[model samples]
Structure formats: structure tokens, C-alpha cells
Target chain A: MRTSFKPLAAGVGGVAAALLLWQAASGARAAGGSLPSVGSVATDLGALAGSPDFWSALAQTVGIALLGLAASGLGGIVVGILVGSFEPVRYATRAALEFLKPIPPIVILPLVVLILGPTGQMSWFLVFLGCLLPIVMQTVDGVHSTDPVARDTARSYGMKPVEILVRIVLPSAMPYIGTAMRVSAPAALIITVVAGLLGGGPGLGQSLYLAQAGGDYPTLYALVIVLGILGLLFQLGTRVAERRLLHWHESYREVAH
Target chain B: MDKLMNKRPVLWLLGIGTPALLLAAWWLASAGSTDTFFPPLADIVDRFRALWLFDHFGSDVLVSLRNLVLGYAIAALAAVAVGFVTALAAPVRWAVDPLIHFLRGIPPVALVPIFISLMGFGPEMRVASIALAAFFPTFIATVDGLRAVDRGLLDVAQVYRLSRRDRVVAVLLPAASPQIFSGLQVSLQTAFVVMIASEMLGPSRGIGAMTLLAQQSFMISDMWSGILLLGVIGFAANFLFDLVRRKVLAWYIGSRRLARAS
Candidate 1:
């Protein structure tokens, strides 16, 4: 217990030192003299904590991200499985997918906004596109990772293909799906913020942009702190989810230590 | 991945069939496009030919490439250097981990306004933002790669009394190349996205700026051309990256192939 406390104390000290360094760099005598102070930023955050608009913007971003995950997650898995299991479909789609996959998701944001207008739904659509590729690729990898011996044994027993897929295949693929979701969830949030900032869509990013435009440096800095906290929370949440969801997998077994 | 195993000559033609069909379908669908927003593909092609090929050599393309290549190259070198130090030194890792996470979580777009305020609407702002956006992924990947290197090999290096530089270059880097390269690929993707985003946010220059400008000016065909130009550049960049990755990882690939054969 005493030894572990040393590292924890060191971590706290490290973080404190970082804060001090930032404050020094952003202080009055700093090069530009335009940087936001840590104290003022914290005070502004305290003030904004009482505002409903702040909460709503936060909610809008998180809501769009969650919805985007839902939109892409299951369908992506099903499509990935289909593509992985089949030959012709995979081959035919390969060239097109390769061409489209490299095009950054932001490139299509304007196209979507132009077609759909700057709605929450539009933001969700953009997030969906942003997340689809990684999830699909990972899911396909998961499906392919299934043990052939297990599959052959199930086949020898004359198990129905549907039953085999549901029972054996799905369980095997769970670890990969968990990993994919972990990756996709963060991407969805980033895309949500991008949509909000650029497409005039609903989210914390919109609020962030507004604060910048309004010259509310304190507010701008505060919102970014809030975003950084939210990102950290999402990361922690996904990690816990991954641990619980993939407890049976070998990867999880290795991670447990 | 399964699609690549069977390398029949005729399969290549079959793979091309879908993209050709899709392009044809797009052309047919937009043949007489009355909508000002969705211009005909032919009109877009004409604009592309005029603005990019026949006109001023697309200087914006050069500007954008300069930003991307310069930013990405600097990021790759700096990340690997920093990652080596952080992974090897426990005190530094403990000291810097929280700071890294805090900075990394702030999305690249969020930094644009701040950078513009600091550096003004100039190439410096664009490059700084792009470099920053490209840095963290490669840094994290390199650290992970370094950490995953075999301690046995490291011990062997120490036992041999190898110089510190020799230890890293000969022992650590090769072991970490695969993961680091994967990180580089992700960094390039992030850089491309940030490059376009930074351009869009700015006083206008690159393909991204051009697209935004054309859209605002009601030059719909020009907007399509700009988007297409971005797509073409992105596709080419990815192809080149893959080629480089293949060359760099050839030894790793060969070993894996041998393992499979046996």
C-alpha cells in the first residue's frame, strides 16, 4: 500500500507541475500576452457550470455520438460478417471500398450538410460515416478470427448454420467487436465535435466556436477543459465496458493482470 | 484479406468492374442535373480540367502538400525521438503521461481559432496545427512499440556493450517498426483531415479553402472539382504510404510468410 501510494503521489505532483508550467507560459509576461490564465479559465468553468446552455451543448454532443455508435455498430458488424464470409461480395466491393476509405470523413461533411441541412441528424450521419470503416474492418477481422476447428466440429454435428453462427461465431467475435467499439466510440465523439464546429450543427463544438467568435477567451478555454474531461470519461467508460464485455476472451485474460 | 490470397489474373479485372459500374451510374443519374447544388459529373470534370490541369498548375495543391508533407515528416521524426525517451525512462513517462492525455483530448479543430490568434492567419498556424494533430498518434504508437520490444533483446544489447545510439538504431527500432509504421499511417490520415480543416477555417488557400470558397461563391462545379481534387490527393497519398510501408516491412513480411509456409 505504501509503495503504490508513492506512484499516486508522484502522478498528482506531475499534474500539478504541468498546471504550474501552463500558468507560467500563459501569464502576463508571456510572448503573446493573449493566452488564457488557468485561474480565469477555472473561474469561468465554475460560472458556466450553472448555465443550462452549457449542459445542453454537452448533451447534444454526447447524444449524437451515442446515436452514431448505435447507427453504425450493429449494421457494421452484420455487413462485416457477410463480407468476410462471402467471396464474391468481398471481391467486388474491395476496389470501391479502398477508394472511399482513404477519403477523410470530413471531406464528405459539407456534402452531407448541403443535402441534409445543419441538423442533429446530419451530425449523426457524419459521425456514422466517420466510424463505419474501422468498426466494419475490425468486425470482419473478428469474424475471420473464429477458430476453424470449432467451426468444423459444429458442422460435423450437423448444426444449422444460423445456430452455429449465433452460438459459436458470435461469441468468438465478441472480443473484436468490443475492441472495434472502443475505437469507434471516440471517433464518433470527435466527428460529433467536428460537425458541430464546422457544419453549424448542434454540440459542444458549436458552443466552443461561438465562444471563440464572441471573444470570450475564458469561456473558450473552459469549454475545451470540459471537452478534455468528457473525452477522458468516454475513454474510461469504454475501457470498463471492454473489460466487462470481453471477460471471457484470451486478450482480456492477458489484460486482467 | 481473403480476397488477396487467390491471385488470378482475371480477378483483377473483376475487381475493377464495380468502380467502373458505379462511375457510369453516377454519370447517368446526373446527366441533366437542373439542381445548382449537384452539378453534372461532366461539368465537374470540365471544371477540374480547367482549374487544375489547364490553368495555373493548382498552386493551392502545392501549398497544401507542403503543409501536409512538412508537418507529417516533422511529426514522425519528433514522435519517434520523444517516444524512445519516454518509454525508456520511467520518471519521464510518469511525469508526462497526464499532460499528454490532457493535450491530446482537445480535438485538432478546437485549436484552430487559438492558433490563428497566436500565429495569425498564416502558413505557420496551418503547419503548427497540422503538426500538432499528427504528433500524438505517432508518439503514442512509438511508445507502445518501444515498450513491446523484447527485454531479452535489450538485455543482449547491454551485455554486448553496444553504444546507446547503436542500441536504439540496431535493436529497438527494427523491433518497433511494425507498430510505429501503423501509427504513422494513422498520423497521416489525421494530418490530412486537419490540413483540410485548418484550410477551411483560415484566410483560404488549399483544396479545402478552394472548396469552401467555391461553395460560398455559388460555383457549384468548382466545388465538385475541389472535392474531387481532395479525393484524388488523399487516394494518392494513401497509395504512396502503403507502398512505403510495404517496403519498410518487407523483412517482417518475409518472416511471417516463412512461418506460414512451414
Candidate 2:
């Protein structure tokens, strides 16, 4: 316990040192009028925390991310299972998936903004597109990795196709699906923020733009801090959820011992 | 799976045919489209040829590419350098761990706004934002790769009394190359996205800015052409990266293949 606490203390010290550096740099540069000190940013954060509008913006961003993730997660799993079950289907779709996967979501930002007109729906849809391909690929990998022997045995034992899929394939795919969720959750948040920032969608990102446009440097910096914390929380929450849900997985079992 | 892969012609056919088919379908389906937002593929292709291939190739595409290449190079070199120092020292790693995590957690696009504040809509801001955003993945991966080097390999190196430079070059770097490449791939993608985001957020001459401007002014075909160029560049980047990876990791991949076969 003592040894572990040492690293934590060191980490806190590092953050403090970084803050000091930021403050010093901002103070020394007379031309850095747009750059605010850490103290002022903190004060702005405190004031913003008391405001109702900040909370709504936070809620809206979270809502878009969650809604997008849920939709993509469901869609990916269903498609992944169907495709993975048939080798020919996998080959048929591989080219399309590979071509589409590497294109960054931002490339479509202009088109989506035009069609949807910078609404929450546009942000939500962008997040969905951003996350869907990775999840589908992961799920397909998980399904392909299902035990062939076990599958054959189930077939020999008179299990129906759907029954085999439900009992055997899905359980095997959960770990991959969990991994996809871990990756996509943060991505969903990032995409949502990008949409707001670039497309003028309502959320903390738009608020950030507004602050920057208005030359409220303190508020802009404060919102960035909020986003950083929110992202950290998302990461931590996903890790915890993955551990809890995948406790029976071999990786977790090995860790437990 | 092995059999399917061995049939090179069939694999090539499937690989090339699918995308070609999709494009053909899109062209046929949208031939008479009346929707302003979803213009006919034919018109978009014409604009793509005129604008991207001829007119703005140097001004927009080449400019964006130069910034991306410079930023990515700076990030990769800096991350590897700093990663070596931080990973070699235990106390430094602990001290900087949270800072790295926090900085990485902030959406890469969000960081662009901070840069805009500090640097104020210059080329420097775009490059700085891209470099910083692209830095984290490679940095983290380098540290992990260095730390996870085989203990026995180090023992062997020490037993041979190898110079520090030789040990790093021959053992540590070769071992870490695969992981570092993966991280670099992610960084490239991040850099591309941030490049677009930065240009879109600022008044710029890049493809992203042109696309947004066209959209706002209702030049639907021009906007589509910009997007089409972006998509092509994105695909080409990944493909090119894979080709380089294959060349660089040829020995590692060959050894793995031999191991699997035996």
C-alpha cells in the first residue's frame, strides 16, 4: 500500500508542476492576452459550475454520445454475427468495410452539417458512423474465434442453428464487444464534441466555440479542463464496466489468481 | 482461410471488384438525383476532376499534405525521444503519468481550440495542434514497448558486454518496432482528423476549409468534390502505411509465418 501510494503522490505533484508552468508561461508573455492563467480558469470553472446552462450542455453532449453508442453497438453486433457466420459473406463485405474504415469521420462533417443543419441528430449520426465499423470488425473477430470443436459438438447434439449461435457464439463475442465498447465510448464523445465545435451543434463544444469567439479565454480554458475530466471519467467507467462484465473471461480469471 | 488466400487471382478480384461495383451502383442510382444536398455522382466526379485534379491540387491538397507530413514527423521523433527518457527512469514515469493521461483524454479537436487561443489562427497553430494530438499514442506505445522488452534479451546483451547503443539498436528497437508502428498508424489517423478539424475551425486555405465554405455557400458539387478528395487521401494514406509496414517488418512477419507453419 505504501509503495502504491508513492506513485499516486508523484502523479499529483506532476499535475501541480504542470499547472505552475502554465501559470508562469501565461504571466510572462505580455502578448499572450488570449491565454489565461490557471487560477483564472479555475475561478471560471467554479462560476460555470453554478450555472444551469453548463449542466444542460454537458447533459446534451453525454446524451448524444450514449445514444450513438447504443445504436452502433446494437447494429454492429447484429451485422457482425450474420457476417461472421458465413465465410463467403465475410469475404464479400471485406473490401467495402476496409475502404470505409480508415476515412476519418470529419471528412463527412461538411455533408452532414449541410443535410442535418448542425442539430444534435447530426452529431449523433456522426458518432454512430465513427464507431460502427470498429465495433463490427471486433465483433466479427470475436465470432470467428469461437471454438470450432464446441460448435461441431453442439451441431452433433441436435442443437438448432439459432440455439448454437445464442449459447456459443455470443458468449465468445462478449469480450470483443466489451473491448469495442471501451474504444468506442471515448470516440463517441470525441465525435460529438467535434460535431459541436465544427458544425455549430448544441453542446459543450459549441459553448467552447462561443467562449473563444467572445474572447472569454478563461471560460474556454475551463471548458477544456471539464472535457479532459469528462474523458478521464469515461475511460475509468468503461474499464470498470469491462472488468465487472468480463470477470469470467480467461484474461480476468488469470488476473484474479 | 489459407486456401482462399493462396488463390491470388480470386482474392484480387474480390478485393478490387467490390469497391468498383459500389461506385458503379452509386453512379447509376444518383444519375438523375434532384436533391441539392445529394447531387448526382456524375456531376460530383466532374467537379472532382476539375477542382481537385486540376485547379486546387497544389493550393489545397499539397498544402494540407505538407502540414500533415511535417507535423506527423515532428510528433513521431519527439515522442520517441521523450518516451525513451521517461521510460528509462521510473520516477519520471510516475510523475508524468497523470499528465499524459489527462492530456490524452481531452478530445484532440478540443485541443485545437486551445491552440487557436494561444497561437491565434496561424499555420503554427494547425501544426502545433496536430503534433500534440498525434504525440500521445506513439509516446505511450513506445514506453510500453520499451518496458515490455524481453528480460532474457537484455540478459544476453549484458552477458555479451554490448555497448549501450548496440543493445538499443539491435535488440530494444527491433523488438519494439511492431508496437511502435501500430501506435504510429493510430497517430497518422489522428493527425488526419485533426488536420481537417483545425482547417474547418479556422479561416484557412486547406481542403477542409474549402469544403465548409462551399457547403455554406451552397456549392454542393464543390463540397462533394472536397469530401471525395479527402476520402481518397484517407484511403491512400492507410494503404501506403500498410505497404511500408510490410516492408519494414518483413523479417518479423516471415519468422512468424515460419513458426505457424511448423
Candidate 3:
């Protein structure tokens, strides 16, 4: 019993120790320059819970992240599958995609800002580019990995090409697409935040930047917590969704002896 | 589908052709643009050559690379060490999981402010930010990798009377390397971005700072140049790392191939 509880107890104790150390550090730094202690940060979080501005900022960032995700996910899968279906199209675009994939989408931030003028549009574009390549690559792999024997069987059965693609190929591809969504979701959020901060867009990132610039350390730290929670929720939500969707997948099953 | 392609010599055309065409198209399309915000591609290239190659590669680009290399190295080493230790101890793992998870969720870019206040807006701050950004992914990977080591393998190690150091160094690290490499790859990418972002966040002498300055000063061509240079470096760095990863994983690949054949 002691051993079993040791891990959990130790975990909690570690966290408490960390918080205490942080409080001490901040307290020491107080004379050099002002910084909030762990207690003060907790207080700020409570104060923020009751603030409308905090809620709005949360909503704004959430809205952008979700919108960007949905748009990129759908567009990417559709276009990816479409391109992946044809050998010529896949081969032709492979070079361009490969070249572009290595380059971070943030490279286009300046141009995006120039064209979109720091609106949610700016963030959307950034998020779109961030999530696009992964989705496309996964979709292409999904299509490519469709069992040739299954394709031959569908053909032998006189199934239409579309029928084979939809009935046979799409299901096989679902796992890959799910993985892609999981992989891309965090990227979409990170880029959205970066876009907001740099592009002057409407999101928690922009707000965090503002707080920092204005010397609102409490608000800055609070927003960081908020963003962290948002990221965790997004990650956890996608993981749950992936697990549910892929429950039947062999890969999702527990390891066999 | 793959076999039929052997009859044709289209690989080169398909592989490099499209990107080349796209590049040409960009140059042509932007040739006549009067927009002050977007200079012609040719002009941008010229600016890129002048600014990055001639003017600030030594000063700005080197700084970025220095920060990236040191930070990423620190992140990778620290992650593996910490992960290895935690994997050996369940209590420590449990104690630290929540904290790690919470920190992992925070966008690395968002920590720039906290780092700025704590470390100040200097090279130290930038490197610290980059290391912080890169650390979580690698650490998670290392822990996952170590944990994912086959139970039977550990049993064999024990039966063989392998010491803990031998068990980890000779058996576990190699076995879990694929996951570790994946984590390192992500760390490489994250470190570069964080390097740039931190520079942009503060008054620093790096390509990120240079780009931000150019944009603010409305040096459209210079901004484009910086963007282009960054894109190339990001691409090349990832490509090179991927090659190294492939080389390191050759043994694993061969084993998998043999398994599949059998």
C-alpha cells in the first residue's frame, strides 16, 4: 500500500515543492524587479475567472482555433484524397509539397499580414498552412496504403471506381486521417497563437502579448495558464476522439503478448 | 502502378519540375506588381542575396544558429537523461507527469514574456526560450520510448544479469531509438521556430529580429528576403536531420524488413 501510494503522493508533493520554490524565487526577485509569487498568480487566476475580458479573449482564441482546424482538416483531406487518387497529380505535386512542407508556414506571415491586415483572416491563413501539409501527406499515405488485393477484388466484382474508393478505400484511410487530425491540431493552435501575437489578430496570443507589453505580469501569466489549459483540452479532446473513432483499429488495441 | 513507371523517365520531371515552374510563375507574376508591400520576386532575391549572404549572415544568422544548436542540444540531452531516470522510477514519473503535461500545453512562444522577465532580453533569454520550447517534445518522446521497451527484453536483461547501466545503454536506448529520433526531429523543428520567435519577441540580433524590423520599417523586399532565407534554412535543416535519422535507423529498418519477409 505504501509503495502504491508513493507515486501519487510523491507527484503531489513534487508539485507543492515546485510551487514553493517558485514562490521563493519570485519573492527574492521582488527587490530586483516586480514579479508575482505563486500565491499572487493564483489570486490573479481567481480574479480573471470573474472577468468578462478573460472570457471574451478565451472565446476569441477558441473560435479562431476551431474554425481554422475545421477548415484545414476538411480542405486538406478532400484535396489530398483527390490528388492521391491520380498518379500523375500525386507525382506532379509531390515536389512542390515536399519543398513547401519543410518550410514553416510562419515564413509567409509577413505576406499574410500585408494582404489580410492583421485580422482573424491572418490567423486563419497561418493555421491553414500549418495544418495543411500533414493532412495532405497522411491522406496520400492512406490512399496509397489501400490493399491492392482489396482493390483487385472490388474491380473483379465490377464495382465502380467511385464505389471502390468510397466503400473500400475511405474506411482504410480513416485511421490515417484521424492521426493526421491529432498531429495537426496542436500545430493549428500554436500557429493561431503565433499569428495572433505577431499579426495583431484577435486571440489569446495577442492578448498575452499586449499584457506583456503593458507590464501586466499577472495578466500575462494568467493568459499563459489559460492558453496552456486550452492547449491541453484541445490535445485531450482530439486524443479521445481519435481513440473513439479508431477503437476498432488494430493499432488502437492493447499490445498483445 | 509502380512498375509501369519504370518504362518512363519522368521521375525528375515530376519531382523537381513542378516546384521550378511555380518559382518561375511567382517571378513572372510579381514582375509587374506596383504594390509597395510586395516587391517583385527578382528584387526580393537580390535583396536576399545582399542582406543575408553579404550583410548579416555572420551577425544575425550565426546568432540564430548558435542559439538553435546549443538549445536543441541541451534540450535533447536533458530530455533523454531525465526521461531515462524517470522511466527507471515509477514514483518520480507519477510525480512529474502532471507538471510536464501542463508545461507542454503552454505554447513555447507564449513563454517568451516570462523568460524575458526572468532571464532578460538577451542571447541567454533566446536560448532559454528555444530550449524550453524544444525540451517537452523530446522529453515526452524519451519517456515514451523508454517505457515502450519490450517487457520481455527487460526480462532477458535481468536473466543475463546485465547491470542497470548496461540494460539501459546497450539494450533500451537502441531498442527505443526510433521513438527517440522522432522526438528529436520534433525538437529540431520546435527549437528553430522558438529561436526565431524569441528573437522577434525581444530586441535581439537575429534573422527574426531583422525580419520584424524590416516589416516595421516597410522594407517590403527585405522582409520577403528574410522570409525566403528562413524558409530555405528551415527546409534544409529538417532535410538534413531526416537524412541523419534515416541513417541511424537503418538497422531497425533492416530488422523490420527481415521480419516482414519472414
Measured against the true structure, the TM-scores of the candidates, in listed sequence, are 0.93, 0.95, 0.96
Off by over 4 Å in 3: A1-4, A253-257, B1-8
- From the highest TM-score down, the ranking of the candidates is 3, 2, 1
How well is each residue in A1-257 modelled by candidate 1, as lDDT tens digits?
97777666767888999789879989854647667888998899998899998888889999999999888997788888897676566667778878888887788776777777889989999988888887777777777878999999999999999988898888898888898899788778888988887787998988977887777878888888888788878877998989988887777886543
| TM-score of candidate 2 relative to the true fold | 0.95
List, residue by residue over A100-202, the lDDT tens digit for candidate 2.
8899899999999899998999999999989999999999999999999999999999999999999988998899999999999999999999999999988
**Reference-based lDDT, residue B45, model 2:** 91
Stretches of model 1 off by over 4 angstroms after superposition: A1-10, A29-31, A254-257, B1-11, B54-58
Give residue B95's lDDT in candidate 3 (0 to 100). Answer: 84
Error of 2 at A92 (Å): 1.4
Q: List fnat, each candidate.
A: 0.45, 0.77, 0.61
Per-prediction DockQ comes to 0.59, 0.72, 0.65
- Evaluate residue B238 in candidate 3 and report its C-alpha lDDT on the 0 to 100 scale: 93
- The CAPRI category of model 3 is medium
Best by DockQ: 2
Give candidate 2 misplaced runs (Cα > 4 Å).
A1-9, A255-257, B1-15
DockQ of 3: 0.65
